[model samples]
Target: MGEIKYKRILLKLSGEALMGKQNFGIDGDVVKFIASEVKEAYEMGVQIGIVVGGGNIFRGVSESAKGMDRVSADYMGMLATVINSLALQNALENLGVPTRVQTAIEMRQVAEPFIRRRAIRHLEKGRVVIFGAGTGNPYFTTDTAATLRASEINADVVLKATKVDGVYDADPVKYKDAVKFDAITYLEVLNKGLKVMDSTAISMCMDNEIPIIVFDLFGKGNLKNILLGKKIGTLVEGKHD
Candidate 1:
């Protein structure tokens, strides 16, 4: 393996990324592919912690939440994240990678409750830890959960896996001339109102001085490339580049 830039990383995957080409729900093939990518990373000796979203299965903030109690909808979304986390855990284990699924909510039968010390221990034991249930709080995005976890675990950086390759000034898909930033500051991202991550998530990372790499999860080898210190995505740090 190439020289790893980060000793530890928090990988944030959207629920939609697990969907593959499917309209909804998890796609088995995509999960397997992602698992293989993660396995490669685990082999590199870099500790990994993962936070996956539930938008594909159920979005807490979507229209479906309209008229329903906000807390209730968010709880439902948390459960959705648990489903994705379990699927990912199964995939990683199938590849012979030791993995643990920890949820913010107490799902004793399925996964262990989130415990910082236990999670770090898992990483030290060469096991990948997957965090699910979005912080066990309503109105908080999985992105926030990722930053929170990364901070608690002292991860070198948070790798946000998105469909887009990097952070662009505008929507690259809609505007042909949109420009992408090779790197940016957290304040710039917040001041410019860049949607790379939600405000809460970005602020938490900023306050903690943690770097974030937003990259395309759909691109083959992108995750490995980033882990190897290749400039495969936009790097957001405390200072601009």
Candidate 2:
């Protein structure tokens, strides 16, 4: 294997990536594809932790959730994340990768409650750890939860798996002349209001000194390529050249 740039990583997967072509909910094929990608990374001996969003299943702030009590809707959204986490777990295990699902909410029946020491132990033992249910708090985005968990685990970096290849000045899909950055600083991301991640998430990563890589999750081999230090995505860190 080539030199591994990062030994431990937190992978932030958006729920919508699991939707594939469906209107909502998990798509079996997409989950399998993602599992395959992650499996390849695990084979390279990279310790992995995942934080999955619930947008595909439900979103507390979306129009579909309008008129509902804010806290109630957010709790429902947290449940959605558990469902997604379980699905991804099943997929990874089916491919012969040892995996565990840890939830922020205490649902002992489905998965273990989030524990910092136990999670670190799992990674040391060569098992992949998946974090679900956000921060178990209302109004906190899953993005923030991912950063928080990364910080606790002392992750080397946060790999944000998105549909886009990297961070752009504008929506590349909507604007034809969007410019991409090879690397950017956290302060620039906040000062320019770039949407690589939510403000809270970005701030937490900055404070913790964890670099963030925004990359195209759908690109086959991209995950492994990143571990090999090929620079497949936009790097967001404390400083840039």
Candidate 3:
């Protein structure tokens, strides 16, 4: 119940995270659990924006790019994100949390089109705005979209909810002795080439001076802990000492 350090935050959730233990697609129970967790933060008066990936349903670059245009494949991936966003919006509303799904690609019948001013207004009204469609451009990952939206929304931080608790020197899943960092600078992340996020996303955040906290969302209370300014994850920021 500590004071929330961030008035508004952009949360980046990987589509794979929504799958839980399932091989693909979203797991209903898992989405519900995440929705509940988001509700906890929302009730505490913290404005939340979400950017979700579509790896669970499709990875266009890897799947349909056999002979098709790369840009077209990427657009398909963006559409997949919109599907995920709608699903999450449904889940959050079922939990009684006010939510909005805004897509870069306008689908008026389903959700709002991405509008920075409108999104900010929604946040001021205490509604959670979910951003989908990955910047509405091809060759951009959801990570970059999260960073871009975080900057546009003037969020205090980008909370990257991942499977691992923090960034590591090597792949923790494969490297048993990988060292986890409690805190790090943007330069360190870039220099070491740690896969905490794509370089484009990291650079965008660094340039905007937006701090990113990498933490495991599956751990109960981790998001709450981070919002309360407790040290629960690896924080990457600009020009750290």
Candidate 4:
């Protein structure tokens, strides 16, 4: 209804977010809820792209993968993202929101392989493109894949959907007196060891001059509010936001 600030956005959804109140795995209701939220933005004529993590199902860097081969564990983790992506696609499609699932790992039976031009075309055609399988390689987190895809797709900003509202001096849940910053530079986030995103992802964003907004997407209409230019999140950029 208001002016749209970010025309195209890359939403990074942690797999744990899809699990809802459960310990792991996809929760259908939560996926539908998220899909509904995304549908709001899509209806507003915003181009959407998503990069989903595999933490809920399996994290390659987690303790569960300590004894396994690092590469093998990472591949499994990538596959887990594909599962989440497919779930999201199904949810979005059920809502009558056109969507596509593209994986870095070529599993043509389930999804299309990642092709930059094709992805842009999908976005241009008013379809939400969900990118899965974390760069299709080992040793890289989905966070990095998100920034990389955002760069390739030329998204206006990277919307990082986390549990917290924004970046705080300390864990807001643990410290009642923690301070929150409305805007912060990328270097400050890395220098202070803030967990807004992984260093590789932050660095890529910094290098590419892409702004990253860390926000609590669980809040109703938070994602759409951001697109509509409401400042309700922490903006991480190369300079002042």
Q: Provide the overall lDDT of each model, using Cα atoms, as 2-decimal numbers.
A: 0.94, 0.96, 0.92, 0.96
Q: Judged by TM-score, which candidate is best? A: 2
Model 4 lDDT, residue 177, Cα: 100
Report model 1's TM-score to 2 decimal places.
0.98
Per-prediction count of colliding residue pairs?
A: 0, 0, 0, 0
Model 4 poorest ten-residue lDDT run: 232-241
Instruction: For residues 1-241, write the lDDT of model 3, one tens digit per residue.
Output: 7788998999999998989999889999989889988988998899999999998887877754678888888898898898889889999999899999999998899989999999999999999999999999988899999999999999999999999989999999999999999899998999999988899999999999999999998988888888999998799997555
Q: Which has the higher TM-score value, candidate number 3 or candidate number 4?
A: 4
lDDT per residue (tens digit) for residues 174-209 in model 4: 999999999999999999999888999999999999
> Comparing candidate 1 with candidate 2, which one achieves the higher lDDT?
2
TM-score of every candidate relative to the true structure: 0.98, 0.99, 0.97, 0.98
Model 1 Cα shift for residue 184 (angstroms): 0.7
The digit string of per-residue lDDT tens for model 2 on 23-115 reads 999999999999999999999999999999999999999999999999999999999999999999999999999999999999999999999
Q: Summarize candidate 1's per-residue lDDT along 1-241 as a digit string, tens digits.
A: 7788999999999999999989899999999988998998898888999999999888978887888898999999999999999999999999999999999999899999999999999999999999999999998999999999999999999999988999999999999999999999999999999999999999999999999999988788888888889998899999974
Q: What would the C-alpha RMSD of candidate 2 be, to one decimal place? A: 0.6
Candidate 3, after superposition: displacement of residue 1 in Å? Answer: 2.0
Pairs clashing in candidate 4?
A: none
Q: Which pairs clash inside model 3?
A: none
